[model samples]
Target chain A: MSAADLSRCSLNSATVKHASLTELVDAAAAAGLGAVGLWRHQVQEAGAEQAARAVAGAGLRVSSLCRGGFLTAADEAGIAAALEDNRRAIVEAATVGTRELIFVVGGLPAVSAPGQGPRPDAGPGDRDLVAARARVADRIADLVPFAAEHGVRIVLEALHPMFAADRAVISTLGQALDLAEPFPAETVGVVVDTYHVWWDPQLREQIARAGREGRLASYQICDWILPLAAEPLNSRGHVGDGYVDFAAISAWVSGAGYTGDVETEIFNEEIWADEPVATARTVGERYARYVRPYL
Target chain B: MSAADLSRCSLNSATVKHASLTELVDAAAAAGLGAVGLWRHQVQEAGAEQAARAVAGAGLRVSSLCRGGFLTAADEAGIAAALEDNRRAIVEAATVGTRELIFVVGGLPAVSAPGQGPRPDAGPGDRDLVAARARVADRIADLVPFAAEHGVRIVLEALHPMFAADRAVISTLGQALDLAEPFPAETVGVVVDTYHVWWDPQLREQIARAGREGRLASYQICDWILPLAAEPLNSRGHVGDGYVDFAAISAWVSGAGYTGDVETEIFNEEIWADEPVATARTVGERYARYVRPYL
Candidate 1:
């Protein structure tokens, strides 16, 4: 019942997206949160140095950097540019004193990195899947040395099915782990987000698999929306707000010897438009009631 | 290909929903289709007795009955009624000489049997996926004996995430198999509809597993529309229209040892508004292009 026990809790800045980087950090500290998670765009907008100073000043931990993915591009040059952008992201994470940079592997070549110029088109066939998957592994290999140099970990987050064509070829924890196998464990890890993975029957087994391999980088929670609309990426809800078994997952993470922070990361329009403090407070209280039972 | 070999293609009556049950059967036969799938309401409207005669008269095989699920009602009476209704459905399938009786397990009690009667309400916080699962198994247990007697198989269809709450508790092929294990394999089975299951990473493995277990009952195909509306059930597209790897699935089905008919079961507004012959020809041609590779 103690607020400090909220040590397990981390305020992913995406949850209180309306708040500026400084305001978000202050809100987390004021709410007695033990850690915070930041997004790269917000970090860039706030100035990485200023954001880092504010986070350290609040005596807060940066659980994870929002992301460094969408690597799929039309050509080799575009892919090279994506690798450079990811390296910069790793540097930004290092500046913020965080080691894990979450990766949402890009979807389709066009959608994942739209700014990249047009390239060859592949039909919707196994050959396309095989090529996309190979491209993902190759890019990860390219980024590994840069990630290693920064003492940073690359945590690939597998998205839901809708994004498979355009997003990550590695679309499940198992698939991500398979891609991570060739890389050093420390250099490549996985972020277990409830929103993307709760529907998986292999949830418990995969979490255990990640832990056993020492690949557990971040534990994130959101909700799974039903009757989903066109755009699958931005439809996430709050923990316990949808049909996912948050308590079961919380229990699984605890059992897996994962003592890291549990970050709340919702991408809903309704929640994002509300007051940031109100959002944080509601998230805090809900996590306590819905997730604490497992603890 | 010979028309008889081409005849193996079946029109899942849902493809030409605007056509009456008799017209669908007549069209399939005239087009030299080997089989057709029929829904209960369509049968009810056309009269199951008359529909059966028409299917037989056209020298058509009833590949599968459209559905007989939503067994997860709120009370004992509701449960009993569902069981009784399933028994009648088995008789109807037998009358039509169809081997498979497809079940779309009902969603949340309220949504499952809308306004049928008052029912017990389930909460969002309630994580009793176990109880819902048990109810599905229990209902199946009641119907297995009747299904066995009728020489008909009960195939539970895996629904999408949107229907997980109220429709079918068995939302995945693996989960559906788990629900089916207690029953005799000949009497209990699973229907693999690409629209419902194409997104599953475990699809190939599960389909292989179902084949090994000899529990794969039927294969249905429909397109999964991208940027789908909020509703999950109503947004299916025609065979070649969406992003699914239909050829790959056909390959999996063939590799998994299913020599049964592959039915096209589309429920799109555009196809529904088209002429029945146009819809049938479109489905047949699309199957030839996107799905015939495996066959």
Candidate 2:
């Protein structure tokens, strides 16, 4: 596949984080990329309108405006604030012609909302498992209508089980689907990131299930670092740098009926220090090389 | 819940790793522990017969062996050797009169079997999730007869997802139970470690499910370190030092009809630096204070 066939591959600004918001858009456009995912901080740094204009002027699409999923342990007041902030983000995404708001659900109450007082800690057994699930679903239910009014689809990203404690209460695709079952698939769906879900046993089937239900809101790719026991965090590898078979995963998602953009979301510290253009060019080429077969 | 209730608490030798096999057994007995879990290396160093004599002399029961799970993956022949070695473990466990053999199902064939050539890497999509699960069941099936002949139960330890790559493919209680579903719940069950399962949203339900089905083999306790994102690996805290709710977990297990031993299993580098007696004493006190409430 040429760069044009790979136009659907979006750059999640995180992949070239060294670049400022303006430079990131310029780099994406210069590279002939069609879509880009923005971080809220980046959007704020450049002024949302200015950033959106930069992408629009470059003829690049705003695939998704990341983040708005920390509803796990926020207080009523905090929740209200977060909802309002998310609404603003949605308006910004809309200004840039982005339709999806990606959610990286917060972990623990403290981590999710740093200033919040610690919630009561439960023992593994004391975890009112039923209540926790209900809490998550209820919070999402409350936020769904607000998100819908903004015409911005909310995509819950399923993190690894390791993050289950303080991060997202929803850890698996199945769990996310269960949460989304009550709402329309289009309004509330999941963003499938390879790095998080690759280790799951039910990946293929879950992707197919999501595809069948049209619940796959976003498709992001990142490789899993080997020797997982080595570096627990800040150890993400670029595509084909580690053990995951991109071709197989891409094939599965494609087969599952997901025709959405394949967003490259890399969270490695190593790549963050590189020159923006070099990072984007290299990663884009590699994804085109290693990940293109499946796409 | 004083020392009297400590009757159901077992000291996995690894918890007091500072001690030799004989010393660990001596320490447990000194603390009035009801049971003890031994490692193959510790047993080998002290001589299996002598180790068995020590436990008997201490009037302490052997809860389960530390491990015999890594089906060596260097080669087919090596894999066969591992099975044979597991048989030896069965004999050893029987000699010591322990009923359950804890299995830490090994990871990547090569890393799992250190001396083996490079093992094939996992795929992009839940790398070999299907194969790993099947292999675990098949390997256990192959060893079941030997275990049955010796009246030894096989407890597949459900590890955290981080270790899913090379430590144990059976990462969750649900996965472990699925592997145990075809086998007798008595013969095949799970070793639920607090550190591993505490983060799982489905933990309580799974524990209850395991108990209802008679699949709860052994219960282990430890604490999870805070600010986990800072240092993902090598940051496990002691029982009350971190965020896990041990008392609540203990209550859930006991409530689930699981009357088995609650083994203290800490894997902290800091504690390991101390002498075995001190570590064992600390574990004993914490087990009594924090865990007793749940019991």
Scored by lDDT, the top model is 1
lDDT tens digits, residue span A1-295, model 1: 6787677788999888788988898888877788899999988998888888888899888999978987766588989889889999999999988988999887655332322222235356422454566788889999999899999999999887556655665667888888899999899999898877776656788889989999999989887654453455677777765667777888888787787888999887788888877787777887788886785
The DockQ score of candidate 2 comes to: 0.34
RMSD of 1: 3.4
Point to the candidate with the largest TM-score.
Answer: 2
Alpha-carbon shift of residue A260 in model 1 (angstroms): 1.2
- Least accurate stretch of 10 residues (summed lDDT) in model 2 chain B? B110-119
lDDT of 1 at B274: 87
Candidate 1 is graded, for docking, as acceptable
Interface root-mean-square deviation, candidate 2: 5.7
Question: In model 1 chain A, which range of ten residues has the least summed lDDT?
Answer: A110-119
Candidate with top DockQ is 2
